[model samples]
Target: MSAARWQRLVDDLAAAGVESSVLDKPYTESVYGCVHHGVSRSITMLHPVSGIISISDRQWSKNPDVWVGWQVFREGRDSIVIRTWPITKKRSDVVAHVLEAFNTEDRT
Candidate 1:
């Protein structure tokens, strides 16, 4: 996925009031590592790994399998990538429940 696409995904998540983070910084560096890294590819390759969802910690982490649709590939770099999992209805449901906690509109 290109940086533009990645930004769009982030924007969608943000608009939906879903909280997301880079988890890795210097976006290019992180993208490079993910594409070339071993476990990183393995973890991200599978689409929407699960159907049933559960909450743990504060971050909304999900199985990549169930939502795996697109992986963000950095432009002009073969070794760079930013992965994005498709938003499933199931995932959206979960996001809605927790969105109040993150949604700007929900805040007073």
Candidate 2:
């Protein structure tokens, strides 16, 4: 299921002309999270647990009920990969939003 989700995400991004990469291995280091890259700025997508914990603690204020599964991180110059899911009322909406945001951002 996750693999399918990942592929769909990749396809969607590709359709939108957003460059992204897939992290095939588990990420272990804080500095080298599961997925790391920069869109307009550097961003790291830690493992699901790490991503949720970090976002919850700092950004979402540790809201357990809040969904924080989907995440994205910079893989390299002008590239990023989706690493987890976002808490949203609608899953499709969340995906669309992410793609829209990425596409809207200036690559150069």
Candidate 3:
């Protein structure tokens, strides 16, 4: 990914009020060794106490156009596996859905 594109993604995430941190080269290289290099490509978005989402540089996922959630031991893992395609979805829609999950009082 180009630096400009990466910056745009970071800006979009910020505008949505999602706390995010860019994964450094060491971390990204270790976790996503096959991903493109030379520019920022991975970030971790945190939803307060609700969940964490990984924006990987891989750009493609098993499901190319949707967000995938995983549960841990029958409990809400509160984790979402987000790839490039879904991140390109309307931010309002993504933010709304994520906010709904974060705002829910009952996790069961």
Would you give me the overall lDDT of model 2? 0.38
TM-score of each: 0.26, 0.35, 0.43
| Per-residue alpha-carbon lDDT of candidate 1 for residues 1-98, written as tens digits (9 for 90 to 100) | 33443445445656875545432223222432564221211011111222111222121346322333332211111222222223333434434543
Between 2 and 3, whose lDDT is larger?
3
Clashes of each: 12, 11, 0
Q: When superposed on Cα atoms, how far off is each prediction in RMSD?
A: 15.1, 11.9, 7.5
- Candidate 1 Cα RMSD (Å): 15.1
Top of the candidates by TM-score: 3
C-alpha positional error of residue 60 in candidate 1 after TM-score superposition, expressed in Å: 27
Model 2 over residues 1-108: C-alpha lDDT tens digits? 444555565566567654554444433333335444321211223332222111111124464223334543322233443333354434355456555444343233
**What number of backbone clashes does candidate 2 have, counting pairs of residues 3 or more apart or in separate chains?**
11
- Cα shift from native, residue 97, model 1 (Å): 13
The lDDT, on a scale of 0 to 1, for candidate 3 is 0.45
- Candidate order by TM-score, decreasing, is 3, 2, 1
A best-first ranking of the candidates according to their lDDT comes to: 3, 2, 1
lDDT of 3 at 76: 34
